[model samples]
Target: MIVRLGIAVRYDGDPLVDFTPMRFLDRFVYRNPKTSEKNARKGDKNVFRRKAYDPLGIKKLAVTSEVSALR
Candidate 1:
């Protein structure tokens, strides 16, 4: 299986001035040979930078359950 993950930023009024592009870095990749399932474990703490005016701060979308079957 192949899994694609990402993040989304939501705001009420306006976008932030110092908005940096977010990325889903697959530091480690895992796959179950028996079940043919693939996954990535990302638990880095310094994933994003938050500004004072940022309402959402830095949020990571669900990545665990976003897997696709590789057929």
Candidate 2:
């Protein structure tokens, strides 16, 4: 997969600035090989996983943020 971060800035009395011309980075999505039909039937539907890398660590960050918000 590919990951990209776009930044846009606008200064007062100035033109809009866009940083979307930057190149995208490569990312990996992993799937559990052991997730079989039986597991799917048992409600183990989410077999895909994301890596915890710089710039965007969705897997770890999302879980922690959601848990904290529930408190």
Candidate 3:
């Protein structure tokens, strides 16, 4: 019989993971030529830009989880 149990929780609050070099590489490799041409016609530069995670947003999410865990 176990009278007590221990659990461990770990949290990392970093948004840099969302901007990886591989994402840019993959985007260029997988982009459709037709789409690229259309975008170019519209004078859109810096194509294949990925949306990165917001630091404040991640912090809010972490705090919400921590609060629930305390309860």
Predictions in order: lDDT: 0.37, 0.49, 0.66
Structural similarity to truth (TM-score) of each candidate: 0.13, 0.15, 0.25
Better-scoring candidate (TM-score), 1 or 2: 2
Whole-model alpha-carbon lDDT for candidate 2: 0.49
lDDT of 2 by residue, 1-71 (tens): 12354555545642333323221121123433565776668786555656446654443466558664775
Clashes of 2: 0
Off by over 4 Å in 2: 1-34, 44-71
- Better model by TM-score, 1 or 3? 3
> Considering only N, C-alpha and C atoms within 3 Å, which residue pairs clash in candidate 1?
none
Residue-level lDDT tens digits of model 1 in 8-35: 5556543453342331222223433332
Summarize candidate 3's per-residue lDDT along 20-62 as a digit string, tens digits. Answer: 8886788889987665676768887767778676676445556
User: Can you tell me which runs of candidate 1 are displaced by over 4 Å?
Assistant: 1-5, 16-71
- Which pairs clash inside model 2? none
Q: Model 3 compared with the native: what TM-score?
A: 0.25
